[model samples]
Target: DTAVSQTPKYLVTQMGNDKSIKCEQNLGHDTMYWYKQDSKKFLKIMFSYNNKELIINETVPNRFSPKSPDKAHLNLHINSLELGDSAVYFCASSLFGENYGYTFGSGTRLTVV
Candidate 1:
């Protein structure tokens, strides 16, 4: 089984549409994160959740939200998608306190046209 998995790996939608991407990890990690990669391939962390609590939210736009219903799942939601929102979104998980390295899910490509 995949250690990490994300649903709807590819999404193409019009501007102003609202969408959500789901991510789940099977590795018993205590921390999970959502990252965004722009066209320039610049990877920036959007949010991090540890043990189902929000933490490490980098100055991400208010339109973006990270929801963690549980420790193993962290989902991302974007409202009023803009053309700039088009990018690859990655979900990753890591074991707290050990720096074991994060296991990343295959990224979801979002294109807003």
Candidate 2:
């Protein structure tokens, strides 16, 4: 029943470990986004890719990368995890234009120990 589904809802790892979060949208939206919410509860847009093309690349660390194999999928890969990397990572999808509306996933909680 999840329009947008992401794997590993909870992730606990040590510093320097690498991890990946997979997101898939069944709504057939043209654009997909990755957002990160820190412990302070501040949401930051990490990346936005439309139709498998890199569109919005925000100011994020090099350890983070977004990959879209097709329009329905967008995955986030994080390398060299750190304690500061602990956050809730959200995946969203939306269509562009006047009817634009975002459909977000439940989010993946990452705890870096």
Candidate 3:
């Protein structure tokens, strides 16, 4: 069983287009997260959800939204894609607490032309 999965592992599009990436985890984790990994490989948390409650990272743009239909799934929606948005999107999940490190998906590469 896949612990975590995200669709469209590679997405190429022109600027100003909107797109959505889907994520699902079968680990029965209570919390799920969306993280962006830039070309330089710096990973940053964008959003997190636990039991359907949204937790926003202050640095994330308002143009990025996260939707969690259930504890097992969280999806990322991006509006008006920009070249700056070209990066790998990773989906992760972990239990709540200090010691929890996330289990990340391979990642979805979003390239804006």
Q: Each candidate's lDDT (Cα)?
A: 0.95, 0.95, 0.91
User: Candidate 3, residues 11-61: lDDT per residue as tens digits?
Assistant: 999999999999999988899989889988898888889888986565877
TM-score of 1: 0.97
Which of the two candidates, 1 or 2, achieves a greater TM-score against the reference? 1
What would the TM-score be for candidate 3 when compared with the true structure? 0.95
Highest TM-score against the true fold, candidate: 1
In the range 1-113, model 1's lDDT, one tens digit per residue, is 99999988999999999999999999999999999999898999999999999988999889999999999999999999999999999999999866589999999999999
For model 1, state the Cα shift of residue 50 in Å.
0.1
> Worst 10-residue stretch by lDDT in candidate 1?
94-103
Off by over 4 Å in 2: none
lDDT per residue as tens, model 2, 2-46: 899998899999999999999999997999999999888899999
Which residue pairs collide in model 2, if any? none
Q: Lowest-scoring 10 consecutive residues by lDDT in candidate 2?
A: 94-103
